[model samples]
Target chain A: MQLSARNQIRGKIKTITLGSIMAEVQVELPDGQQIVSAITRNSVETLQLHENDPVIVIIKSTEVMLGKQA
Target chain B: MQLSARNQIRGKIKTITLGSIMAEVQVELPDGQQIVSAITRNSVETLQLHENDPVIVIIKSTEVMLGKQA
Candidate 1:
């Protein structure tokens, strides 16, 4: 399936923290940089994700904000 | 103002294409890499953005998705 979201970063799941409704999944890149993602717990279950799993970080352009320095 | 977005990239506004309701904004980084953002025209007007303006690209964690390789 085609994705409209333009930004895609490859990384490995470093950790998964589940909350009541949301889940925080940390993805560590090969370069050692980490990104945190907060997704629905249901989506996490649907994805069957676990630590050390390879995944792509998908971010939609519509959700992106352009901020100017104040 | 404080932002909840976890991912922020420093860039400059490269272009802006406005539609009836939405607008596509292209931000160019120092190394010449570009990121595209689809934002509401209302936000574009609120920001008073123009080409070549310095801006930061913001992506929130909750909106981020993890895509597993098939």
Candidate 2:
């Protein structure tokens, strides 16, 4: 699913999914790191994502709901 | 804020920020719309975001904390 929008979140893909279509990534910064929780697989195919691939992660601030992992 | 990761979320930028560096976007899908709430500006510049630009939004499932907007 290709989208033409303007909200891009760029970061290094610290990790990829283990079994299912999922992965963990961290956004590098001059100060610190903004580690995000999940990255979907379908998105990978749509975005043609790969390891070490310079990619952008867009987040609607409102969509950024705070929670703790189990 | 440029990042080389593998988790890319693709979607359309429904709206941009009014005053502050903020915006609201909607991701199109085969079934329904996954209306996420917020998109940050720094992430935008990092990815060189522009209007109608195809971009990816990376979300750590853990980071996806569910909540209501006030």
Candidate 3:
């Protein structure tokens, strides 16, 4: 399936911290960049995510915001 | 105001394509990577964004997703 999200970076799961209804996943890029994602608990279970698993980070262009230094 | 978004990258606005109620912004990173953002026209006006303006790219963690190769 095709995704409309503009950002799709490849990374490895560094960690997954589960909460009541949410999960925070840390994805480490090959360039050493780190991105934290907070997704639904169900998504984690559905994806069967685990540490060191290769995954694509998905972010929609509409979800992006621009801020100038104040 | 502190934003809950986990990703905030530094870049400069490259272009702005305005529509009836929305606008698409292209930002170029220091490393020449580009990020596209689609936002409300009101937000563009509110922020008064312009080309060549230095900006921060903000994305909420909850808006992030992970996809594994099927």
Highest lDDT model number: 3
Q: List the residue pairs that clash in candidate 1.
A: none
iRMSD in angstroms, per model: 2.9, 9.4, 1.9
Off by over 4 Å in 1: A28-34, B28-34
lDDT of 2 at B65: 63
Q: Judging by lDDT, tell me the better candidate of 2 and 3.
A: 3
TM-score of each: 0.72, 0.37, 0.82
Q: Pick the candidate with the highest TM-score.
A: 3
Q: Give the TM-score of candidate 2.
A: 0.37
Tens-digit lDDT track of model 2 for B1-70 = 4332344556665545532576455554334466454655554455555555554665445455678999
Give the top-scoring candidate (DockQ).
3
- Model 3 interface DockQ: 0.66
> What lDDT tens digits, residue by residue, belong to model 3 across residues A2-62?
8877878788999999998999999987656677999988989998999999999888898
**What tens-digit string does per-residue lDDT give for candidate 2 at A1-70?**
3322344555666555532666455555334566564655554555555566555666545555688999
List model 1 lDDT by residue over B1-70, tens digit each.
8776776767889899999999999987665656789999998999999999999888888878899977
Model 1, global lDDT? 0.84
